[model samples]
Target: MKNASAINGYEMFVIQMLFSGAAAGFIYPTFLIRSTEGAYWIPIAVWIAGALLSSWLYSRMLARLEDNKLIVVIRSSLGTIWASILCLPALLFLFGALIVMLRAYSEIITMTMLPTTPISFLNGMLLAPASLALAGMMPIVRAARVFFLLALTCTLALLILGFSDIDWTLGTPLLRTNGDFLLDKHFYAGSFLWMGFTITSLIGSYRMQSARRAWKSYVIALFCALPFIAGYVYLPIMTFGRELSQRLTFPFVSKMDSIYHYWVVFENMTAIFVSVTMLYVLLIMALQLHALGETIKSLMPRAKTGLIYVIIFIVVYSVATYLSSWRAVEQIVFITVGIRLYMMFVFPLLGMAVLAFAQRRGGKGNEI
Candidate 1:
């Protein structure tokens, strides 16, 4: 090899996109957002199906390119003329989603937990770390790994602390079928959380160095994800029956407080636990910002990509800051996901078919 770069582009791309890509902070909130709309069960089930379809699409995108995040893959194979066109919509949607998360999360803190604190203070408090992390992708990823572990441990603690108190009787007879309206609601809610994982396949382009790099990564990733998914699923089932679970926002947080521990230091352990969990969410947003920066630099070399990242950062925070409450943020979240469905689904199929064509032509396709 003639002098490989210090941070291989693939690794760099992966590092930036990995921390938050899989978790998809903006997209995951859609479950709650859609839940607010009243379909209750259908949206969740649709979401679960979406995750499966997304996984297939993701795998195909992986087949389309050797490495680099989706943005790079598009530019390389599709050509900048076409790629840039495709990219514009992505930037607005993804960037908008990021803002929605910022606003919603900040509101969650101020409204639910810190009623006395000013919104500006809450936004600044959260933005400082996100800004610091976005400035350096590598350190931010490392921090995310640490935060992931901490979040995992805290989740386990929550399970142990709260499980016994959950009245098993309360959730009995999980009506295999909610009424016509509610059945639709349940499916979409289930799927909404999984939909955020689509970015993993996009970023997995870089993480998966080879078809057979290591089994451990898959195991570890799966293990980590199960707890996160199960915990969310568990809280709604254990805390509120299907009917009430459908009605609540932040069901997990409500259940945490319902578990009474007289000796426990805080009466509202949910707020503390939830606050910590938001750090995990911040790690996700930082990663996306970094990926956007790297992708812009790779494709549009004349423009300073960091400046683009800064502009995006400003846009996301500005929109978030202007949003007065979490409810408005929630509406934006679902609509975004609904809009992404078409692109997210179609892009992978196109990439896969073209890549297959490239492979048949001996792994060459108008290399950028």
Candidate 2:
């Protein structure tokens, strides 16, 4: 690993791109399509506004830390006991994301390309990311850069191809909503799509960077992903009416299979979609594992970090493999909805409050 300062806003941007891309493929659209009867974009718009607000608070919290780890900064602001209590939910959030991601992607593979492949074997995909996570953040960033290029090119081509066979009339009621999604649990479950800012905060602070710059990078990355996210949900709805689109598990993949072009080189568009999304999923999984490792190290400075990474890999992989069905993956995500909401909205506010209190009391206030 290199100095944490070596990580810059652009590197963070690329990583966020991967996180957003993976969500576009896996769970985000399913939840959105099911949660609303009117305009799907309304729920998306609401979530984006929520994400931007939470990200602003997080950047403010990071600004006060300079080059300190978030947990370490909180410990300096508050006592060890209070810091640990505040940080535990974040740790659980990371672990829950890992479980849901690993299981969900494996289930996707089974449903798409490799129907005969065993779930346990497909779940072994975590080993690659776990190894990279142990190697440290720089490697993951470098890998994200490479994967982002390939994944972006492939993804853009597919999105273009998806426009070939759509009936615009089927998409009537393009922009109608009565705010029904506000009461849906699936709407809350979709918060995972907007969690890139929160996840990257675990990497500690960048050297000499302003909070505004970090926040802007995330904002840009997320907005750039709007087409991909919107296309994933709406493209399928336009192709197959909402009723049929809601029934399919991987709607975009089904949309891809529906695309038939005489000039196109590929025989199977579904395979292309699955393969490209795999790159995004694997890289983001590595990012999550790295975040989890860093959080545990901050909490227990004396523990062997390598051993900690191994234990995390083993535990997450085992649980993900043993999940009985795809329904279980969604259930776990639904169960963790409260924790995700806390991390998104409450955690940053609490961190900022503690820092302000410590500075007022003249305790480690001048360190930054």
Candidate 3:
């Protein structure tokens, strides 16, 4: 593993973009399409604003701890018992996310390209990320840079192609929103798409990286990802209309399958779409696994780190491999909505509070 000092804000940006692409393509659009009767952009706008606020607060918290990383500061300030208690939800959210994504993509591959393939063999894709996560952050960052270029280029091309047959009429109710999605669970379930900052924050030791630089990287990446998220939702609605788009499980995949441009050489756009998305998924999985492993190590500092990662890989792989259906994956996402929200909105504020209290106590002791 290269030193943590070698990691930088740009690397974090690439990692965030990878996470956004991975979530945006497969499951998120369906939730957004179903969440509101008004313009799909309303829910998206609301969520993007919320994501920016959450990331800003998180960056400020990191800024306050100029000398130590979040995990180390939390451990010293809150004590091991309290820090473990605080981070329990983070652990749950990461683990649940990993399972949902692994199974969801595995199901997609089965339905789209490999009807007769065993799901167990498909889930084995996690093995690559698991090995990289165990190797550490720099390795993951290096891998993410490569995947980002390939995945981004292919995804943008698909989105452009999506514009070919879209009917502007089907996109009616463009500026309307009644805040109906506020009551819908699925709206909140789509939070995974905007959680790049939270995921990167868990990678300890920013070292020489500043909070300002990190926040800038995150915001830029978020804007860069806007089209993917917007295209994934609106393209399908424009192509098939709202009523039909919501009914489809993987709307973007269906959209890809429907495209018939002669200039496009690939006979099966679905296969190409899935292949590129797999690259995004693998890198994001490594990020999640690394975050989960880091949290566990902080909580149990004496435990063997390799053993922790190995056990994590086994449990996640086994559960994901045996998942019965796509419905089950969605159910898991629904169940974790509360955890994800707390991680996004509440966790950073709580961490900041703890840090402030710690700093005050340290000041008093110094004065004494």
Candidate 4:
């Protein structure tokens, strides 16, 4: 890829924030509420901490290797065989994320807006962003910039509008469970919420001006997403209480429905919330498909981009449609949480080890 066509730090920041923020709109809150029960804040904190640590480590690796893509760094440091082996999990993690999120968003739409509309139709609508992705990374990044401001405005508006119904007292017993919750098997399951940081590895090769600036953009994006994520989980608990919030399909949407917007045209703000979130989801799916295409190109340099996209679209659309029910989608998502956790934490450390080994063998000259 030419340096001129690559995305800058601000564009990367916008894309990452939109991708991560989309998780906040739908799945993350549900997982946090389910796993932590009354102590959802503890898990949320853990996920954020994990995200920051991974981002820092990833940035350090990017600086040391000076490669635009993590796959290139891995291939350079570890050779083709080992690098391909390592990349398999990362690819699966990306594809798994695509499947889970595609179904999750479709489920949300069916439950909220189009009760009678088939999920197959919703899944097909999602491909709209894939068309942009087919044009290449620049289009996806530019689209992210366009959608970022509008998404941020609508998200903040919903949060501010929902504050009127927040019952702070419902958040009692902050530490309902003991510290054991931190070590619980499911603690890291929330990692999916913060997996947006992985975009650094995916897009790092896209000509970031400075590692320092790129890191700053990453940190800023995380902070930008904090309020929305925290509110997505906490606001609902504060509004509906722990038990009821946990029971609802989407407590955040429920919270939005409870709010009355006098000046707004739509009687229920949940529709607007869904519309904005759908945009976010579309961008995320585009990025995922883009990542899949890039990974395939990296593996088979001679492969056609059109064929790669077709395969990705087929796999994603087939899996998403065949899931048949929300419960099935939930099961797949739960299974992939482990894979996501591995990619988020262990994969980068492995890359660090490869870099260290390569540096020891050839010193600075062989770093890239």
The residue-by-residue lDDT of candidate 1 on 1-368, one tens digit each, is 11111234334333322333234322343354334333333344544456556655665456445554556656766678777776665565566656755665666676567889876666664455457545665566456556655665665677678675666665443444344433333233223245343433433244344312222233234334554554554555566765666566666666666777778776787786666667666766665565555556656767875577677667766777787667766666545654465446765676667566646655344452
Give the range where candidate 1 is weakest over 10 consecutive residues by summed lDDT.
Answer: 1-10
lDDT of 3 by residue, 65-151 (tens): 764668878998989999989999999999899999999999999999999999999999999999999988888888888778888
lDDT of each: 0.54, 0.86, 0.88, 0.77
Clashing pairs in 3: none
* Candidate 4 local lDDT, 188-291, one digit each (tens): 55677777767546653632345556767878988877888888988989988888877887889888888885776778788889999988998888888787
For every model shown, the clashing-pair count is: 26, 0, 0, 1
Best by TM-score: 3
TM-score of each: 0.76, 0.95, 0.97, 0.91
Pairs of colliding residues, candidate 2: none
Candidate 2 residue 297 C-alpha distance from true site, Å: 0.5
Location of the lowest summed lDDT over 10 successive residues in candidate 4:
203-212
| RMSD to truth, every model | 5.4, 2.0, 1.5, 2.7
Q: Rank the candidates by TM-score, best first.
A: 3, 2, 4, 1
